[model samples]
Target: MKSTLNSTSESATAAIFLSAVLFCFAPVCSGEESSNKRTGEDIYKQFCSSCHVAGGNTAKPSKPIAGSKVLKSIATFQEYLENPPGHMPYYKTVVNDKSMVRKLYEYCKKLKQTQGA
Candidate 1:
């Protein structure tokens, strides 16, 4: 009777632990979190603002994004981000998909228009 009770207690503990772990990761795994809801501006502030501030590149002043040809099209912008040159970091993981790339591209284009560049 004692061994059976201990076994049941251990099984209950394991089940609770597994449930907690799964609950913590379920949102991330299912793509039902805020990461999917972040806007282009949010992404820019989080990842790009440090270097590309207000459409200007602090690292490479001559290559400001305000009027660059990279924003000519979504393909060009996505390609450049995935395989950037100079001091730019590769954003394959952050941008990750077409929707994210499109959002960033639109934001950059808007910046260019607003900045009159």
Candidate 2:
């Protein structure tokens, strides 16, 4: 009888510990999922709007994002973001994930199209 009680107690303790561990990580996992679900426009507005207003480069008028050759392909766009030049800051960390880079690229392309570039 004593052995049975001990085993039951141990089982309950393990179950509680597992539940607590999962609970602690649930919010982090959900937050990441929600962030990933954000659209391309959402990402652009949040991160790029200040520098590239309406798809135009406020700092460098000549090198506007609209109709830029950099947006011609995903590879080029990723490379530019990873290793930006001039006043542009490096976005390697911001666009660390491939899906995020693709989302930003698509948003920029849409901007180009809308601007008649």
Candidate 3:
């Protein structure tokens, strides 16, 4: 019985260690691969909202891009705005760097959440 208890404790400890490692490294690695480091929210405001009009882009092919219709849900919106297509013009030349891109992503995500669309 004591041996079984020890084994269970060891498993629990390993699980906790793995979880901590994942939680810590997830954000770090995510920052590495992505081009635009700005949070989705900042990126949207800097590039999308200004001309998007009503916080939504209705310029052409992509109509009212910054709205609820743009994304099925709030969480999804955050993910999509992170890497806008080339049609939108690459922020790399302007924003450059990865960290800035992440911030931009965060900003755009916030705009969508606040605009309620």
Candidate 4:
């Protein structure tokens, strides 16, 4: 009888643990299901960093591309990134991972205020 009770208790605990794991991941999965936009910092890191790094400690670009006329007009950095100059491979495929672009935009906006970005 004691063994039977222990087994049932273990099963119950396992069920609760599984439920928590599913619940924790639910919001993250749902948010990413519909989008692939990268945050701004992601754009900076993935695309801009190489050139910008050589430019200086400041995140400013060599040719001032960050605040350039082209990057400014677009509501989303993703749109700009989707079709960078001919040299830049279109991320339309690499960026297929959901919400990557959206998160990248958020990260870009953060670099302005936070060094962690």
Error of 1 at 85 (Å): 0.6
Residue 2 displacement in candidate 2 (angstroms): 25
Note the Cα lDDT for every prediction shown. 0.81, 0.82, 0.55, 0.53
Q: In model 3, which regions exceed 4 Å deviation? A: 1-46, 67-87, 113-117
Task: Give the candidate number with the greatest lDDT.
Answer: 2
lDDT by residue for model 1 (75-109), tens:
89988998899899987656687777777888888
Candidate 4's displacement at residue 62, Å, is 6.8
Candidate 2 local Cα displacement, residue 69, angstroms? 0.2
Residue clash pairs of candidate 2:
none
Q: Model 3 over residues 4-103: C-alpha lDDT tens digits? A: 9999999999999999889878756655544444455544556766656555655443555544454555445444444665555544443444455445
- What TM-score does each of the candidates earn? 0.66, 0.68, 0.36, 0.45
Alpha-carbon runs more than 4 Å astray in model 2: 1-24, 27-34, 113-117
Q: For all the candidates, what are their Cα RMSDs to the real structure?
A: 5.2, 4.2, 11.2, 6.9
Q: Candidate 2: minimum summed lDDT over ten consecutive residues — where?
A: 108-117
How many collisions between residues are there in candidate 1? Answer: 0
Candidate 2 lDDT over 13-101, as tens digits, reads 99999998898787555556455777988888878888788998877777888789999899999989888999987765456888888
